[model samples]
Target: MSEPLLSIHDFSVTYDVDPPVHAVKGVTLELARGEILGLAGESGCGKTTLAYGVQRLLKAPAVITNGSVMFHDASGEDVDINALGAEEMRRFRWDKISMVFQGAMNSLNPVAQIGSQLEDVFEVHRPEMTPRQRRSEVADLLELVRVGAQRARSFPHELSGGMRQRVMIAMALALRPQLMVMDEPTTALDVLVQREIIRQISQLRHEFGFSVIFITHDLPLLLEITDRIAIMREGEIVEVGRAEQIWTDPQDAYTRTLLSSFPRLTGERGVVVR
Candidate 1:
Protein backbone atom coordinates (compact mmCIF):
# COMPACT_ATOMS: atom_id res chain seq x y z
CA MET A 1 0.00 0.00 0.00
CA SER A 2 1.11 3.59 -0.54
CA GLU A 3 2.27 5.61 2.43
CA PRO A 4 -0.46 7.38 4.29
CA LEU A 5 -0.86 10.95 3.09
CA LEU A 6 -2.71 11.96 6.23
CA SER A 7 -2.69 10.27 9.66
CA ILE A 8 -4.74 10.84 12.79
CA HIS A 9 -3.29 9.29 15.93
CA ASP A 10 -5.54 9.08 18.98
CA PHE A 11 -7.24 12.39 18.15
CA SER A 12 -9.91 13.76 20.46
CA VAL A 13 -12.00 16.93 20.76
CA THR A 14 -14.21 18.53 23.37
CA TYR A 15 -16.63 21.44 23.54
CA ASP A 16 -16.54 23.58 26.65
CA VAL A 17 -19.77 23.35 28.58
CA ASP A 18 -21.12 22.15 31.89
CA PRO A 19 -19.02 19.00 32.35
CA PRO A 20 -17.85 19.46 28.74
CA VAL A 21 -19.15 17.56 25.75
CA HIS A 22 -16.85 15.05 24.12
CA ALA A 23 -17.45 15.45 20.44
CA VAL A 24 -14.70 13.14 19.23
CA LYS A 25 -12.92 10.31 20.93
CA GLY A 26 -9.46 8.92 20.28
CA VAL A 27 -9.88 8.22 16.57
CA THR A 28 -6.92 6.93 14.58
CA LEU A 29 -7.36 6.88 10.81
CA GLU A 30 -5.26 7.12 7.68
CA LEU A 31 -5.81 8.25 4.08
CA ALA A 32 -3.65 7.11 1.22
CA ARG A 33 -2.62 9.52 -1.54
CA GLY A 34 -5.25 9.87 -4.29
CA GLU A 35 -7.79 7.83 -2.32
CA ILE A 36 -11.39 8.77 -1.59
CA LEU A 37 -12.23 7.91 2.04
CA GLY A 38 -15.78 8.41 3.32
CA LEU A 39 -16.74 9.40 6.85
CA ALA A 40 -20.26 8.13 7.44
CA GLY A 41 -22.34 9.14 10.44
CA GLU A 42 -25.51 10.95 11.40
CA SER A 43 -25.58 14.57 12.49
CA GLY A 44 -23.67 15.57 15.64
CA CYS A 45 -21.48 12.49 15.24
CA GLY A 46 -18.23 14.51 15.18
CA LYS A 47 -17.60 13.93 11.50
CA THR A 48 -17.38 17.65 10.84
CA THR A 49 -15.60 18.33 14.08
CA LEU A 50 -12.88 15.84 13.16
CA ALA A 51 -12.48 17.41 9.76
CA TYR A 52 -12.32 20.88 11.30
CA GLY A 53 -9.76 19.75 13.82
CA VAL A 54 -7.51 18.32 11.10
CA GLN A 55 -7.62 21.62 9.24
CA ARG A 56 -7.12 23.68 12.42
CA LEU A 57 -10.43 25.47 11.88
CA LEU A 58 -11.75 24.89 15.36
CA LYS A 59 -12.70 28.10 17.12
CA ALA A 60 -13.03 29.01 20.78
CA PRO A 61 -14.94 26.77 23.24
CA ALA A 62 -13.90 23.74 21.20
CA VAL A 63 -10.49 22.30 21.95
CA ILE A 64 -8.32 19.50 20.72
CA THR A 65 -7.20 18.05 24.03
CA ASN A 66 -5.36 15.03 22.70
CA GLY A 67 -3.57 13.45 19.70
CA SER A 68 -2.09 14.79 16.51
CA VAL A 69 -2.82 15.22 12.80
CA MET A 70 0.19 14.30 10.71
CA PHE A 71 0.06 15.43 7.10
CA HIS A 72 2.62 14.11 4.59
CA ASP A 73 2.84 16.40 1.61
CA ALA A 74 3.86 15.62 -1.97
CA SER A 75 7.43 16.69 -1.23
CA GLY A 76 7.75 13.82 1.27
CA GLU A 77 7.77 16.19 4.25
CA ASP A 78 5.59 15.21 7.18
CA VAL A 79 4.34 17.83 9.63
CA ASP A 80 2.06 17.78 12.63
CA ILE A 81 -0.62 20.17 11.40
CA ASN A 82 -1.99 20.76 14.84
CA ALA A 83 1.32 22.32 15.89
CA LEU A 84 1.77 24.84 13.11
CA GLY A 85 1.73 28.56 13.91
CA ALA A 86 -0.74 31.09 12.56
CA GLU A 87 1.40 32.26 9.63
CA GLU A 88 2.46 28.75 8.71
CA MET A 89 -1.12 27.54 8.90
CA ARG A 90 -2.31 30.39 6.67
CA ARG A 91 0.08 29.22 3.99
CA PHE A 92 -0.90 25.59 4.58
CA ARG A 93 -4.68 26.02 4.42
CA TRP A 94 -5.20 26.53 0.67
CA ASP A 95 -1.82 25.67 -0.79
CA LYS A 96 -1.52 22.21 0.69
CA ILE A 97 -5.08 21.50 1.87
CA SER A 98 -8.51 23.00 1.16
CA MET A 99 -11.97 22.43 2.59
CA VAL A 100 -15.42 22.71 1.04
CA PHE A 101 -17.69 23.91 3.82
CA GLN A 102 -21.10 22.34 4.44
CA GLY A 103 -23.95 23.90 2.46
CA ALA A 104 -21.21 25.50 0.42
CA MET A 105 -23.59 26.44 -2.36
CA ASN A 106 -25.12 29.01 -0.03
CA SER A 107 -21.73 30.18 1.15
CA LEU A 108 -21.01 32.21 -1.97
CA ASN A 109 -21.38 35.98 -1.96
CA PRO A 110 -24.71 36.94 -3.45
CA VAL A 111 -23.49 40.38 -4.36
CA ALA A 112 -20.32 39.42 -6.25
CA GLN A 113 -19.98 38.00 -9.73
CA ILE A 114 -19.00 34.34 -9.82
CA GLY A 115 -15.79 35.07 -11.67
CA SER A 116 -14.77 37.65 -9.07
CA GLN A 117 -15.27 35.13 -6.27
CA LEU A 118 -13.13 32.64 -8.11
CA GLU A 119 -10.48 35.24 -8.76
CA ASP A 120 -10.32 36.07 -5.05
CA VAL A 121 -8.77 32.67 -4.38
CA PHE A 122 -5.92 33.39 -6.75
CA GLU A 123 -5.57 36.93 -5.45
CA VAL A 124 -4.99 35.68 -1.93
CA HIS A 125 -2.86 32.65 -2.76
CA ARG A 126 -1.02 33.61 -5.93
CA PRO A 127 -0.54 37.35 -5.65
CA GLU A 128 2.37 37.24 -8.07
CA MET A 129 -0.02 36.49 -10.97
CA THR A 130 -0.91 39.59 -13.00
CA PRO A 131 -4.49 40.79 -13.46
CA ARG A 132 -4.72 39.22 -16.94
CA GLN A 133 -3.36 35.92 -15.62
CA ARG A 134 -5.90 35.83 -12.76
CA ARG A 135 -8.77 36.41 -15.18
CA SER A 136 -7.51 33.67 -17.47
CA GLU A 137 -7.13 31.34 -14.48
CA VAL A 138 -10.68 32.08 -13.38
CA ALA A 139 -12.02 31.24 -16.83
CA ASP A 140 -10.10 27.98 -16.83
CA LEU A 141 -11.45 27.09 -13.39
CA LEU A 142 -15.03 27.68 -14.48
CA GLU A 143 -14.49 25.40 -17.46
CA LEU A 144 -12.97 22.78 -15.19
CA VAL A 145 -16.21 22.39 -13.19
CA ARG A 146 -18.12 22.31 -16.48
CA VAL A 147 -19.61 25.70 -15.77
CA GLY A 148 -19.26 27.57 -19.07
CA ALA A 149 -17.30 30.83 -19.12
CA GLN A 150 -20.45 32.78 -19.99
CA ARG A 151 -21.80 32.21 -16.48
CA ALA A 152 -18.72 33.83 -14.96
CA ARG A 153 -20.32 37.28 -15.24
CA SER A 154 -23.49 36.10 -13.48
CA PHE A 155 -24.12 36.49 -9.78
CA PRO A 156 -24.42 33.58 -7.35
CA HIS A 157 -28.20 33.97 -7.10
CA GLU A 158 -28.45 33.61 -10.86
CA LEU A 159 -27.10 30.05 -10.95
CA SER A 160 -28.82 26.82 -10.11
CA GLY A 161 -28.08 24.96 -6.86
CA GLY A 162 -25.75 22.47 -8.54
CA MET A 163 -23.91 25.17 -10.49
CA ARG A 164 -23.31 27.16 -7.33
CA GLN A 165 -21.92 24.06 -5.66
CA ARG A 166 -19.68 23.54 -8.67
CA VAL A 167 -18.42 27.10 -8.35
CA MET A 168 -17.50 26.44 -4.73
CA ILE A 169 -15.68 23.31 -5.82
CA ALA A 170 -13.83 25.21 -8.53
CA MET A 171 -12.60 27.72 -5.98
CA ALA A 172 -11.40 24.95 -3.66
CA LEU A 173 -9.43 23.30 -6.47
CA ALA A 174 -7.92 26.58 -7.66
CA LEU A 175 -4.90 26.12 -5.44
CA ARG A 176 -4.41 22.50 -6.52
CA PRO A 177 -4.11 21.32 -2.93
CA GLN A 178 -2.84 17.84 -2.30
CA LEU A 179 -5.86 17.02 -0.15
CA MET A 180 -9.46 18.24 -0.38
CA VAL A 181 -11.73 17.91 2.64
CA MET A 182 -15.35 17.95 1.54
CA ASP A 183 -17.86 18.30 4.38
CA GLU A 184 -21.25 17.27 3.02
CA PRO A 185 -20.54 18.79 -0.39
CA THR A 186 -23.79 17.44 -1.88
CA THR A 187 -26.25 18.32 0.85
CA ALA A 188 -29.62 19.98 0.12
CA LEU A 189 -29.52 19.31 -3.61
CA ASP A 190 -32.16 17.12 -5.28
CA VAL A 191 -31.33 13.45 -5.84
CA LEU A 192 -30.36 13.90 -9.48
CA VAL A 193 -28.27 16.98 -8.77
CA GLN A 194 -26.56 15.20 -5.91
CA ARG A 195 -25.66 12.32 -8.21
CA GLU A 196 -24.23 14.72 -10.80
CA ILE A 197 -22.11 16.56 -8.25
CA ILE A 198 -20.82 13.27 -6.87
CA ARG A 199 -19.98 12.07 -10.36
CA GLN A 200 -18.16 15.32 -11.10
CA ILE A 201 -16.13 15.00 -7.92
CA SER A 202 -15.14 11.45 -8.80
CA GLN A 203 -14.07 12.46 -12.29
CA LEU A 204 -12.11 15.44 -10.99
CA ARG A 205 -10.35 13.20 -8.48
CA HIS A 206 -9.32 10.82 -11.26
CA GLU A 207 -8.06 13.67 -13.43
CA PHE A 208 -6.32 15.71 -10.73
CA GLY A 209 -4.86 12.88 -8.64
CA PHE A 210 -5.82 14.59 -5.36
CA SER A 211 -7.03 12.67 -2.30
CA VAL A 212 -10.37 13.45 -0.66
CA ILE A 213 -11.77 13.00 2.82
CA PHE A 214 -15.49 13.06 2.01
CA ILE A 215 -17.77 13.50 5.03
CA THR A 216 -21.45 12.70 4.80
CA HIS A 217 -24.26 10.71 6.43
CA ASP A 218 -25.29 9.12 3.13
CA LEU A 219 -24.04 5.54 3.23
CA PRO A 220 -25.18 4.48 -0.26
CA LEU A 221 -23.49 7.42 -1.95
CA LEU A 222 -20.31 6.79 -0.03
CA LEU A 223 -20.33 3.12 -0.97
CA GLU A 224 -20.76 4.07 -4.60
CA ILE A 225 -17.85 6.53 -4.70
CA THR A 226 -15.42 5.90 -1.88
CA ASP A 227 -12.71 3.25 -1.84
CA ARG A 228 -13.10 2.76 1.95
CA ILE A 229 -15.67 3.71 4.53
CA ALA A 230 -15.34 4.66 8.19
CA ILE A 231 -18.54 4.45 10.23
CA MET A 232 -18.73 7.04 12.99
CA ARG A 233 -21.24 7.21 15.84
CA GLU A 234 -21.41 9.27 19.00
CA GLY A 235 -18.06 10.83 18.24
CA GLU A 236 -16.36 7.48 17.68
CA ILE A 237 -15.51 5.45 14.62
CA VAL A 238 -17.18 2.10 15.11
CA GLU A 239 -16.08 0.30 11.97
CA VAL A 240 -13.58 0.92 9.20
CA GLY A 241 -13.41 -1.29 6.13
CA ARG A 242 -13.29 -1.45 2.35
CA ALA A 243 -16.56 -0.52 0.61
CA GLU A 244 -17.42 -4.09 -0.50
CA GLN A 245 -16.56 -5.60 2.88
CA ILE A 246 -18.58 -2.96 4.65
CA TRP A 247 -21.58 -3.45 2.41
CA THR A 248 -21.54 -7.26 2.44
CA ASP A 249 -20.20 -8.05 5.90
CA PRO A 250 -20.38 -5.20 8.38
CA GLN A 251 -18.50 -6.04 11.59
CA ASP A 252 -20.63 -3.88 13.85
CA ALA A 253 -24.36 -3.85 14.60
CA TYR A 254 -24.41 -0.08 14.27
CA THR A 255 -22.93 -0.37 10.78
CA ARG A 256 -25.64 -2.80 9.82
CA THR A 257 -28.32 -0.54 11.24
CA LEU A 258 -26.94 2.37 9.27
CA LEU A 259 -26.99 0.30 6.11
CA SER A 260 -30.58 -0.71 6.81
CA SER A 261 -31.69 2.91 7.19
CA PHE A 262 -31.30 3.66 3.49
CA PRO A 263 -33.82 2.24 0.97
CA ARG A 264 -32.21 0.86 -2.15
CA LEU A 265 -33.20 1.93 -5.65
CA THR A 266 -34.16 -1.60 -6.79
CA GLY A 267 -36.92 -1.96 -4.17
CA GLU A 268 -34.70 -4.12 -2.04
CA ARG A 269 -33.86 -3.28 1.59
CA GLY A 270 -31.38 -5.97 2.60
CA VAL A 271 -29.55 -6.31 -0.69
CA VAL A 272 -26.61 -4.21 0.46
CA VAL A 273 -25.58 -7.03 2.70
CA ARG A 274 -26.49 -9.80 0.29
Candidate 2:
Protein backbone atom coordinates (compact mmCIF):
# COMPACT_ATOMS: atom_id res chain seq x y z
CA MET A 1 0.00 0.00 0.00
CA SER A 2 1.15 3.56 -0.58
CA GLU A 3 2.17 5.68 2.39
CA PRO A 4 -0.73 7.39 4.16
CA LEU A 5 -1.39 11.00 3.18
CA LEU A 6 -2.89 11.82 6.58
CA SER A 7 -2.55 10.07 9.94
CA ILE A 8 -4.44 10.45 13.22
CA HIS A 9 -2.88 8.74 16.22
CA ASP A 10 -4.49 8.06 19.59
CA PHE A 11 -6.82 11.00 19.05
CA SER A 12 -9.37 11.98 21.67
CA VAL A 13 -11.73 14.92 22.08
CA THR A 14 -13.73 15.93 25.14
CA TYR A 15 -16.57 18.35 25.68
CA ASP A 16 -15.85 20.26 28.89
CA VAL A 17 -19.11 20.38 30.77
CA ASP A 18 -20.54 19.25 34.06
CA PRO A 19 -18.94 15.80 34.06
CA PRO A 20 -17.25 16.04 30.69
CA VAL A 21 -18.47 14.02 27.76
CA HIS A 22 -15.85 12.21 25.75
CA ALA A 23 -16.84 12.82 22.14
CA VAL A 24 -13.99 10.92 20.54
CA LYS A 25 -11.96 8.22 22.27
CA GLY A 26 -8.46 7.35 21.21
CA VAL A 27 -9.38 6.98 17.53
CA THR A 28 -6.54 6.16 15.19
CA LEU A 29 -7.13 6.34 11.44
CA GLU A 30 -5.25 6.94 8.22
CA LEU A 31 -6.13 8.10 4.69
CA ALA A 32 -4.23 6.77 1.69
CA ARG A 33 -2.93 9.33 -0.81
CA GLY A 34 -5.77 9.05 -3.31
CA GLU A 35 -8.32 6.87 -1.59
CA ILE A 36 -11.82 7.77 -0.42
CA LEU A 37 -12.45 6.73 3.20
CA GLY A 38 -15.97 6.79 4.59
CA LEU A 39 -16.76 7.54 8.21
CA ALA A 40 -20.23 6.16 9.06
CA GLY A 41 -22.16 6.46 12.28
CA GLU A 42 -25.48 7.60 13.72
CA SER A 43 -26.20 11.15 14.85
CA GLY A 44 -24.03 12.50 17.70
CA CYS A 45 -21.63 9.60 17.19
CA GLY A 46 -18.60 11.92 16.93
CA LYS A 47 -17.98 11.62 13.20
CA THR A 48 -18.03 15.38 12.72
CA THR A 49 -16.23 15.93 15.99
CA LEU A 50 -13.39 13.71 14.85
CA ALA A 51 -13.21 15.53 11.52
CA TYR A 52 -13.13 18.91 13.23
CA GLY A 53 -10.52 17.74 15.72
CA VAL A 54 -8.23 16.46 12.97
CA GLN A 55 -8.23 19.92 11.38
CA ARG A 56 -8.02 21.80 14.70
CA LEU A 57 -11.36 23.46 13.95
CA LEU A 58 -12.90 22.77 17.34
CA LYS A 59 -13.57 25.71 19.62
CA ALA A 60 -13.45 26.02 23.42
CA PRO A 61 -15.64 23.65 25.48
CA ALA A 62 -14.66 21.11 22.88
CA VAL A 63 -11.01 20.35 23.54
CA ILE A 64 -8.46 17.92 22.20
CA THR A 65 -7.24 16.08 25.26
CA ASN A 66 -4.70 13.97 23.42
CA GLY A 67 -3.54 12.91 19.96
CA SER A 68 -1.63 14.06 16.91
CA VAL A 69 -2.53 14.70 13.27
CA MET A 70 0.38 14.33 10.89
CA PHE A 71 0.20 15.24 7.23
CA HIS A 72 2.64 13.62 4.83
CA ASP A 73 2.91 16.32 2.19
CA ALA A 74 3.83 15.50 -1.41
CA SER A 75 6.79 17.85 -1.09
CA GLY A 76 8.49 15.32 1.24
CA GLU A 77 7.69 17.45 4.28
CA ASP A 78 5.82 16.02 7.24
CA VAL A 79 3.52 18.58 8.83
CA ASP A 80 2.59 18.46 12.51
CA ILE A 81 -0.96 19.79 12.26
CA ASN A 82 -1.41 20.31 15.98
CA ALA A 83 1.82 22.24 16.30
CA LEU A 84 1.15 24.83 13.62
CA GLY A 85 0.65 28.43 14.74
CA ALA A 86 -2.34 30.55 13.72
CA GLU A 87 -0.80 31.97 10.56
CA GLU A 88 0.75 28.65 9.59
CA MET A 89 -2.52 26.83 10.09
CA ARG A 90 -4.37 29.43 8.06
CA ARG A 91 -1.93 29.05 5.18
CA PHE A 92 -2.00 25.26 5.49
CA ARG A 93 -5.79 24.79 5.40
CA TRP A 94 -7.03 25.55 1.86
CA ASP A 95 -3.56 25.07 0.31
CA LYS A 96 -3.28 21.52 1.64
CA ILE A 97 -6.68 20.49 2.98
CA SER A 98 -10.24 21.81 2.55
CA MET A 99 -13.64 20.84 3.90
CA VAL A 100 -17.09 20.73 2.31
CA PHE A 101 -18.98 21.44 5.50
CA GLN A 102 -22.44 20.04 6.19
CA GLY A 103 -25.12 22.36 4.78
CA ALA A 104 -22.29 24.14 3.01
CA MET A 105 -24.47 24.92 0.01
CA ASN A 106 -26.97 26.68 2.24
CA SER A 107 -24.10 28.52 3.89
CA LEU A 108 -23.25 30.55 0.80
CA ASN A 109 -23.79 34.27 0.92
CA PRO A 110 -27.38 34.89 -0.14
CA VAL A 111 -26.65 38.29 -1.66
CA ALA A 112 -23.42 37.39 -3.42
CA GLN A 113 -23.30 36.02 -6.95
CA ILE A 114 -22.10 32.42 -7.25
CA GLY A 115 -19.04 33.40 -9.27
CA SER A 116 -17.95 36.01 -6.73
CA GLN A 117 -18.28 33.47 -3.93
CA LEU A 118 -15.95 31.09 -5.78
CA GLU A 119 -13.60 33.94 -6.56
CA ASP A 120 -13.34 34.57 -2.81
CA VAL A 121 -11.41 31.33 -2.41
CA PHE A 122 -8.75 32.58 -4.84
CA GLU A 123 -8.84 36.04 -3.31
CA VAL A 124 -7.86 34.57 0.04
CA HIS A 125 -5.48 31.79 -1.00
CA ARG A 126 -4.16 32.85 -4.39
CA PRO A 127 -4.01 36.60 -3.92
CA GLU A 128 -1.17 36.91 -6.41
CA MET A 129 -3.57 36.15 -9.28
CA THR A 130 -5.13 39.06 -11.14
CA PRO A 131 -8.91 39.70 -10.97
CA ARG A 132 -9.26 38.54 -14.59
CA GLN A 133 -7.43 35.31 -13.77
CA ARG A 134 -9.61 34.71 -10.72
CA ARG A 135 -12.75 35.14 -12.78
CA SER A 136 -11.42 32.72 -15.38
CA GLU A 137 -10.60 30.18 -12.68
CA VAL A 138 -14.07 30.61 -11.17
CA ALA A 139 -15.68 29.82 -14.52
CA ASP A 140 -13.50 26.75 -14.88
CA LEU A 141 -14.40 25.54 -11.38
CA LEU A 142 -18.15 25.95 -12.03
CA GLU A 143 -17.86 24.02 -15.27
CA LEU A 144 -15.80 21.32 -13.56
CA VAL A 145 -18.54 20.73 -10.98
CA ARG A 146 -21.09 20.50 -13.81
CA VAL A 147 -22.67 23.72 -12.65
CA GLY A 148 -23.00 25.83 -15.78
CA ALA A 149 -20.76 28.89 -15.96
CA GLN A 150 -23.90 30.95 -16.69
CA ARG A 151 -25.01 30.34 -13.09
CA ALA A 152 -22.03 32.42 -11.96
CA ARG A 153 -24.14 35.55 -12.33
CA SER A 154 -26.96 34.08 -10.23
CA PHE A 155 -27.47 34.37 -6.47
CA PRO A 156 -27.57 31.48 -3.97
CA HIS A 157 -31.37 31.56 -3.78
CA GLU A 158 -31.63 31.36 -7.54
CA LEU A 159 -29.96 27.96 -7.93
CA SER A 160 -31.44 24.59 -7.13
CA GLY A 161 -30.26 22.70 -4.03
CA GLY A 162 -28.05 20.41 -6.09
CA MET A 163 -26.61 23.29 -8.07
CA ARG A 164 -25.73 25.12 -4.85
CA GLN A 165 -24.18 21.95 -3.48
CA ARG A 166 -22.17 21.59 -6.68
CA VAL A 167 -20.99 25.16 -6.33
CA MET A 168 -19.86 24.42 -2.77
CA ILE A 169 -18.02 21.39 -4.08
CA ALA A 170 -16.43 23.58 -6.76
CA MET A 171 -15.23 25.93 -4.06
CA ALA A 172 -13.75 23.03 -2.12
CA LEU A 173 -11.98 21.87 -5.27
CA ALA A 174 -10.83 25.40 -6.05
CA LEU A 175 -7.36 24.90 -4.65
CA ARG A 176 -7.08 21.23 -5.59
CA PRO A 177 -6.14 20.28 -2.04
CA GLN A 178 -4.76 16.84 -1.34
CA LEU A 179 -7.59 15.83 1.00
CA MET A 180 -11.22 16.99 1.25
CA VAL A 181 -13.39 16.17 4.26
CA MET A 182 -17.11 16.08 3.44
CA ASP A 183 -19.61 15.88 6.28
CA GLU A 184 -23.19 14.88 5.36
CA PRO A 185 -22.81 16.60 1.99
CA THR A 186 -25.87 14.90 0.54
CA THR A 187 -28.26 15.62 3.35
CA ALA A 188 -31.58 17.38 2.63
CA LEU A 189 -31.34 16.61 -1.09
CA ASP A 190 -33.79 14.37 -2.93
CA VAL A 191 -32.74 10.84 -3.79
CA LEU A 192 -31.98 11.69 -7.42
CA VAL A 193 -29.90 14.70 -6.47
CA GLN A 194 -28.10 12.65 -3.84
CA ARG A 195 -27.15 10.03 -6.38
CA GLU A 196 -25.97 12.68 -8.80
CA ILE A 197 -23.84 14.29 -6.08
CA ILE A 198 -22.27 10.96 -5.19
CA ARG A 199 -21.52 10.25 -8.83
CA GLN A 200 -19.94 13.66 -9.22
CA ILE A 201 -17.80 13.12 -6.13
CA SER A 202 -16.57 9.74 -7.35
CA GLN A 203 -15.84 11.14 -10.82
CA LEU A 204 -14.11 14.19 -9.37
CA ARG A 205 -11.86 12.03 -7.21
CA HIS A 206 -10.85 9.93 -10.19
CA GLU A 207 -10.26 13.02 -12.31
CA PHE A 208 -8.27 15.05 -9.77
CA GLY A 209 -6.70 12.25 -7.69
CA PHE A 210 -7.50 13.95 -4.38
CA SER A 211 -8.16 11.91 -1.24
CA VAL A 212 -11.57 12.24 0.44
CA ILE A 213 -12.88 11.56 3.93
CA PHE A 214 -16.67 11.26 3.48
CA ILE A 215 -18.60 11.33 6.77
CA THR A 216 -22.26 10.43 6.99
CA HIS A 217 -24.80 8.19 8.71
CA ASP A 218 -25.61 6.49 5.39
CA LEU A 219 -23.83 3.13 5.51
CA PRO A 220 -25.16 1.80 2.20
CA LEU A 221 -24.18 4.99 0.44
CA LEU A 222 -20.64 4.67 1.77
CA LEU A 223 -20.59 1.02 0.70
CA GLU A 224 -21.39 2.17 -2.80
CA ILE A 225 -18.64 4.78 -3.18
CA THR A 226 -15.82 4.39 -0.66
CA ASP A 227 -12.68 2.25 -0.93
CA ARG A 228 -12.92 1.51 2.82
CA ILE A 229 -15.50 2.13 5.50
CA ALA A 230 -14.84 2.93 9.16
CA ILE A 231 -17.85 2.44 11.44
CA MET A 232 -18.01 4.64 14.51
CA ARG A 233 -20.07 4.06 17.66
CA GLU A 234 -20.21 6.46 20.58
CA GLY A 235 -17.01 8.19 19.40
CA GLU A 236 -15.00 4.98 18.90
CA ILE A 237 -14.32 3.02 15.75
CA VAL A 238 -16.08 -0.31 16.09
CA GLU A 239 -15.01 -1.73 12.75
CA VAL A 240 -12.67 -0.78 9.90
CA GLY A 241 -12.22 -2.70 6.68
CA ARG A 242 -12.58 -2.72 2.93
CA ALA A 243 -16.10 -1.78 1.75
CA GLU A 244 -16.77 -5.27 0.41
CA GLN A 245 -15.51 -6.96 3.55
CA ILE A 246 -17.59 -4.77 5.79
CA TRP A 247 -20.68 -5.41 3.66
CA THR A 248 -20.11 -9.16 3.37
CA ASP A 249 -18.82 -9.99 6.83
CA PRO A 250 -18.79 -7.36 9.53
CA GLN A 251 -16.99 -8.54 12.64
CA ASP A 252 -18.36 -5.94 15.02
CA ALA A 253 -21.86 -6.33 16.40
CA TYR A 254 -22.46 -2.62 16.05
CA THR A 255 -21.56 -2.73 12.39
CA ARG A 256 -23.87 -5.65 11.79
CA THR A 257 -26.67 -3.91 13.61
CA LEU A 258 -26.16 -0.79 11.51
CA LEU A 259 -26.26 -2.82 8.31
CA SER A 260 -29.36 -4.63 9.47
CA SER A 261 -31.10 -1.35 10.17
CA PHE A 262 -31.16 -0.65 6.46
CA PRO A 263 -33.27 -2.58 3.94
CA ARG A 264 -31.21 -4.89 1.78
CA LEU A 265 -31.44 -4.94 -2.00
CA THR A 266 -32.34 -8.17 -3.81
CA GLY A 267 -29.90 -10.45 -5.70
CA GLU A 268 -26.37 -9.65 -4.66
CA ARG A 269 -24.31 -8.78 -1.59
CA GLY A 270 -21.16 -6.63 -1.47
CA VAL A 271 -21.76 -5.11 -4.88
CA VAL A 272 -20.37 -1.59 -5.23
CA VAL A 273 -22.65 0.72 -7.19
CA ARG A 274 -19.93 3.18 -8.10
Candidate lDDT scores, in order, read: 0.92, 0.93
Clash pairs (backbone) in predicted model 2: none
**How many pairs of residues collide in each model?**
0, 0
Query: Weakest 10 consecutive residues, lDDT, candidate 2?
Result: 265-274
Model 1, 1-274: lDDT tens digits are 5878999999999998789989999999999999999999999999999999988899969999899999998898998998899999998998889989999999999999999999999898899999899999999989999998888899999999999999999999999998999999997899999998889988999999899999999899899899999999999999999999999999999999998888878865665666
Whole-model lDDT for model 2 versus the true structure?
A: 0.93
Kindly report which residue stretches of model 2 are placed more than 4 angstroms away from their true locations once superposed: 267-274
lDDT: which candidate is best?
Answer: 2
